[model samples]
Target: MVAGDGQGKNIHDLPDEIILDVFSFFSFNELIDILQNVCVRWKRLAHDPVLWCDKEYIVRGRAQNGRSCCGVTCSECAHCRCEKTDREVLRTAGMMPQLWTLTMMRGTRARILRKICRNCPNLTTLQLHGCQKMNYSLLKYIFEKCPKIEKLIIANNLLADRQYTELVSCLEHLQSLEVFENRRGAGPVLLRFLADTCSKLREINLSCDYHPLEDVEYFVKAKRDTLTSATVRWTMAGKRCVVPVLKEAASSLKKLQLRLFDVALEEEAATFADLGELHNLRELHCNQLCPHRPRLISLAFQPGCLPLLQKLDLPHATDLPDDAVVTISRGCPSLRHLSLTFATSLTDGALAEIHRLKHLQILDLSGCSGLGGSAVAHVAQLPALRTLLLQYIDDLTDLQPSLRHVLDLKQLRCLDILYSGHIRAVPFEEFSVRLVNFRELHVTYEEEDEVFYKNVLLRCRVKCLGSG
Candidate 1:
């Protein structure tokens, strides 16, 4: 039999790119924790550098979510009952001394985490969320052993009263720091200390009510030379504090997210105008959730911030008009990924402007109630689109038939229609192997809808990546 004839060859014969494309759906955490243990072939493929470069060499330990775990073949995660994930991660970390990325969720025991940190001394990127499950000594151990770590993320966790100052100070080479909570030890003290001691820090994301913007300003003033990305959340009443901070880091700032607690301040002094000064700014997200509604107010399309952006998200921008889309098209020529979720005022004119962006690859028009089915045609003509999201377009009844436009997108890989009101499951029946790049479909979660997609995707060899 020939190599192609199933008689002699097996999955090992398939090209690596095909396998990596399927593996891309699973996070790095899942890849090492479960899939690598399935068999020797997969274990070897699991450590492929292509996958590692895309998501880093992450070792994960997460709690059972009741859904299937491991990969597509497994129906359920029976091993989770005994917490096999943690043990497997501990073993893998020790085995793979080259691992540089690690994420430990709530399930991983503190001792196991400490062990992994002790083993992976070459780590450069580390993320630990749900830190309530562990203690401070584990972090101390990680810093002591993994001193070369440059990017660090700690979320949904707390810290000791003034211990953050001591802990973070240890990573003299730290470049990126993201801490989502600061009810206790995380605040100006940590940032201030890093500013004084560490000059390589490039990114900072802190979400807290503890001395919010005032201290961030101080850190930016001190370390503006290297700061490139900044994301901060606070309970304050105004967004004016961020103006000067952005100005200070304008020369180096490339990515920024600021929480505008009070929507009124967004329009008062045109504070967002200051962003126009940041000629180097690339990505801006001002659509922070507010007490009344979640709208990204007019952070105008400053000519300076637009041209260089590769990704832009303006979700729930109720006030965004069609003209703003015009500015986006003319200003952001290199824009690749754009999200206008719930921008209810836009019509087909916005998509027309977007169609002008020849390099656009990902488009999210979810909840754009004003858009007509013509959007389907406009986006289908785009040359490089790989992912398209149209989640809440319930009123656009015409979308059901116009979806045939998707067949034209040869590079399209993922199309999401979660909670898409009028579109039924029947249209997806036509999708098949002819659309080779199409691998993932996101559908609504009703029993009939899920069953229909499962049957169709099974025949098409596509993955149904959960429901909205």
Candidate 2:
């Protein structure tokens, strides 16, 4: 019995499947650390295909570690360890044959990538960010190897017009794609390919260098069946060209995003003129475009469309006339969350309408310089408001520090009043002592001045008045 137990100890103590399960809990770095210390049997077990089933590549080092770290330049820095750490790391990782996902920075060595692809035949999800060194050959190799890829993020400046078309033509099964500006491909060509091939595509983040609006239109028309979300951030040159395309394609889209440089509100608003036609649209975001305030009046008050609306984010919608707010509140009673950043046009009257929004959980009014103490006071009264951002508002008048009373929001989770100007001082001791139920709080006031904020909340919590 003793001899048999010794022989069993000499062999692997656990089953192969159990060993793989144990290794899955450790990260690649942790596995590498284990490999450096463990014996041959453990190292081989660590390199099992089950352990490398989901390869997650992390891209670090930008400013400090460059040529190969951030941009296209590839200069070796011994101190800077990007993706190209050492040959042994690559050799050991190159064993898995059934790779499901490959997420690596473009800065990684092509040799390493070749090994990875050769080993992993069933790769499904591929994400390469800031991979400027990758050439057409690597992309072609990836397409050939991973035909079943469902999600792809290639932010490498490698694919030209021809290579871009060829590579995209191969990824017919992709459901989601995110291509950053690092790639050197014609946006229109990629869009055209997506329209032609990717029928199951649902979400796309085409943040690459701008493409002509005509291409945008074609792609939108192609994915009209399943395309719901698109995030398009064009370069300065691309913005002007894509607006016309958006105007034509806006009718069918449910979720759309644009990053503008010096574009006008009128032109941006025109893109959404056909937005009302997107009857199935539930979410809409405009990063920097002038908010379609006038259209808000029509869309909000009148029974046009967007009955299934839930979330609306209009960051640059600066001039939301009071009537428009009323229209929206009266019209879309089903809205759950609303984000109105830099909305300079919203007045105290808008707050009255906001109260009617019983379902609103998150309200972001960041950069709205027009909102003053009165508007803020009204906001505090919102019963359903959970998260509120009031950054960059200048004018704030004297409201007693114990504002926890007038604004009876026990459900509040987060409050941001940074840079909202001087909050009038009230006695730290007499401040409305409520049960401090908040989880997160951000105040732009100084430590010395924060007596009205921190101390009051802390002291009130002791009394347990506002305890939820």
Candidate number achieving the greatest TM-score relative to the actual structure: 1
lDDT of 1 by residue, 1-468 (tens): 133565887555778777767666666557767768777877777666555543333333344432222432222432121123655655666644446666544445667777777876777887775543645776687789898888887753443245655677678888888876624543333556667777788898866545556666778899777889988653332343555566787778899776644535444335545555666767877573332322222344645455688778877776677777767776777788889889888877776766667898889989888887676777777888989998877754756455677788888888887777655632566667545687787765555566666776654444444443
Candidate 1 Cα misplacement greater than 4 A, ranges: 1-93, 107-110, 130-138, 155-163, 182-189, 234-240, 260-263, 266-269, 288-299, 302-305, 400-413, 422-461, 465-468
C-alpha lDDT (0 to 100) for residue 337 of candidate 2:
76
Q: Which candidate's lDDT is highest?
A: 1
Model 1: lDDT of residue 363: 90
lDDT of 1 at 41: 71
| Error at 398, model 2, angstroms | 6.7
> TM-score for each prediction?
0.73, 0.68
List clashing residue pairs in candidate 1.
none
| Candidate 2 lDDT trough over 10 residues, lowest sum | 459-468
Question: Per-residue error at 121 for model 2, in Å?
Answer: 6.7
Distance from true location, Cα of 80 in model 1, Å:
14
| Model 2 vs. true fold: TM | 0.68
